[model samples]
Target: MDKAEKDQQDDSQDKMVLESVSGRRLSYDMKTPFYGDCRDVDDFKKLNRVGEGTYGVVYRVNDTKTGRICALKRIRMEGETDGLPLSSLREIMILKRMRNRNIVNVTDVAVGPQLESIFLVMEYCEQDMGTLMDAVPTPYTPSEVKCLMLQLLEGLNYCHKNYIIHRDLKLSNLLLTREGILKIGKLKFPDAQHQTHGIDLIVLFAADFGLARTLSFPSKPMTPKVVTLWYRAPELLYGDAHYTTAVDMWSVGCIFGELMKHKPLLPGNTEQKEIELIVNLIGSPSDAIWPGYSKLPFAKTLNIPKQEYVRVYMQSKPESFFHHTENAPLLSSFNNLKLEFPRATEHTLSLLSGLLTYNPKARLNVKQALRHPYFIESPRPLDPSLLPTYPEIRNQVSEKEKNRRAHDEERKKRLAHEGNDSIFSADHYKKRRKD
Candidate 1:
């Protein structure tokens, strides 16, 4: 072919390709489907932030499309180089599968303009159990406590039936709707992991499964670093890799005690200290108590002696010998569950004993706990409609806000002190010169 004909044909092909590219870009721009589902994150107006944590920031938002108030949780993607976080993915996946009255619902999910942000649209609950307990001046009656507990058990039962174990069950995670329905919230993905000094009563839903695991026969060994220190089970403290739902029951027992006393049952500063506190309150475990007690990963490595040694003189031998006690000195140790919660009934104590049983095998599962006489006898679980109503407690500032205010206050105080020091120095210099 001639050079001129070849050049003309090439130009025509290039022009057509450019036109096709332009058409595709325009189509994409016009389509603009919602970032994830119904709308972008910007579609929801953030009214105020409700809570914040390592995984996400929760905001009270208004959906402009539906004009409905909702809780929008923005999953933190900051500094994430490996793409979307596994925590966010697990939460979204789990919430999609779980559908129950007691469980919190993830209504929608949306992303920001740059796809850097992921917001989970959830059903808004007026307050969480922690906030309600803190704000409400009136304490919940035993019947009311039963009602809440039943709801929690119901939710937990559902989870267990589905093979999901909520590893981080706490008051803050149990959200309360205006209608007195308890919906679990803050379903986080598993990892290694409150203050209610005068708080009275609260929830029926288990929340915060960040460290939660699915049940498996001969469950795969997982990190023992789960559950908050206060609500943590002894098996976890002992570094037991293999565990089941019993760990959750132990947490429930702690919560049960808290409801009765309005204070934490076993508050500890460190893992060792926490173990010490548990030993002090429940008596140290022996082979009989915790069958495989010595086999725990941390048991042999513990800084403290496995058994308490007492020095005693042997009259028969006429020599000094040490009497080794297998378990913590029972005389010095006491189970103060009853002492601390004197008002709790015998049935209540029995139930608590089952839930808090040192042996994981003996510990009551959610089903057994729900059927316990403590719940069935005397005052039955109150009707949901009859649950006491309290004024919604809304914190004026988020955690970040509180910290910022504190920083400002400290800065002002430092500036004031520095100013005083400068004036004092000036006055002293003048006096010395005059002299």
Candidate 2:
């Protein structure tokens, strides 16, 4: 009798627990149906790996349902036991909210059977600016560079306006599509006006928002090691934590210089080397030029060389003259930047200087940069459609392979020269012995 009663009580308790669990599940389902609508990663067919970064591995995939090509980015979850990385979450949240022609569009998010296997489905771009720059035989002309810069600035302007900052703005993060049309929310411009010389217009897109963040009032401290070393701003190098969009403007300046020169403007191996490069290129920063510069954490450790004083004339109601100390220790005061880019036009140089200004406060904003005289000059910005197309280098050969080949070729040439020198020395020794 006691055993039968105990078994019946246990059954009643189990039934109550099941009902409670069902009620909670129903409540969550009603609140948000996001998980319910998510598609499986298996739905898209993997084409090839396009890129791999700190946060994700990007692949060119085809949508089996629509037969449309898309870029699939799988979020990297290695050693991540907590959940989705905050950077990935921020990227997904930002991309989903932003809709601009110059910015890459995220179509959907696909998940795998496991909780960690998450992927972002985005519009496929034919080429990234970094690979194209490295693969192309020639550098982009001034007009073409202007066109690309304009699109990049437009995208950054949009992001900044929305209180977002793309901490990492490098050539690699920029995407370009073969299509020329500019499609807004519901409006599409697929007319002849968008074409140039019978070629469809190319569209530039700002992609990979992994390190992006929303700006807050009364600036907060952030990690200074964000932008790539080559494009990092001087302030960031000096350990400025309370940075702003000015950091992005500095990167744009670096990109501008790279486009004109066909190489990195400040390609340094280490942070100290990077700072030295910046100082050499743009002149040393001082408290006079950059307010609070001397107070920066890294400023005191820098060994900035002293420069000579030059006579500066000021034109006013009554002309005034004074000895102004030149800050460029390595460069002549008269040829600070002209010596670097001898072919750059006056307006172009001015724009570059404005962007790469030492002071964050004095740096050109996106709006100001877009309206610079360089864009309005004789060699105006070529239309995006007119930009030349290049073969997808990523498909042909990876960057790593190209670098390895170059290194191997150099080593072979070096070894061959050494071998010839050794042979000559051996012949001389034999002749001496015969004599």
The digit string of per-residue lDDT tens for model 2 on 1-435 reads 699997886675444323322221222112112122234577899989987765567899999988999988876555556444333343344465568888777776666656466677888888877777887869888888888888888888887787766777877777888863222111111122221221121111123553565676677677687788999998888899899988988999998889888888889999888877777766777887678999999898967655432212211111111122122211112235567899887667767877888788877777777766678777888898988876777778767899998986676566555665664454444465479
Candidate 1 residue-wise lDDT, 170-248, digit = tens: 7777888878888766765322221111112001111243455566665766668878898899899889989888888
Span of ten consecutive residues with least summed lDDT in model 1? 195-204
RMSD of each: 14.6, 15.6
**How accurate locally is residue 291 in candidate 2, as Cα lDDT from 0 to 100?**
86
Report lDDT (Cα) of residue 36, candidate 1: 21
Clashing pairs in 2: 201-385
Estimate the TM-score for candidate 2.
0.72
Give each model a TM-score: 0.71, 0.72
Off by over 4 Å in 2: 1-36, 85-91, 180-207, 307-335, 397-435
How many clashes (backbone N, Cα, C below 3 Å) per candidate?
Answer: 5, 1
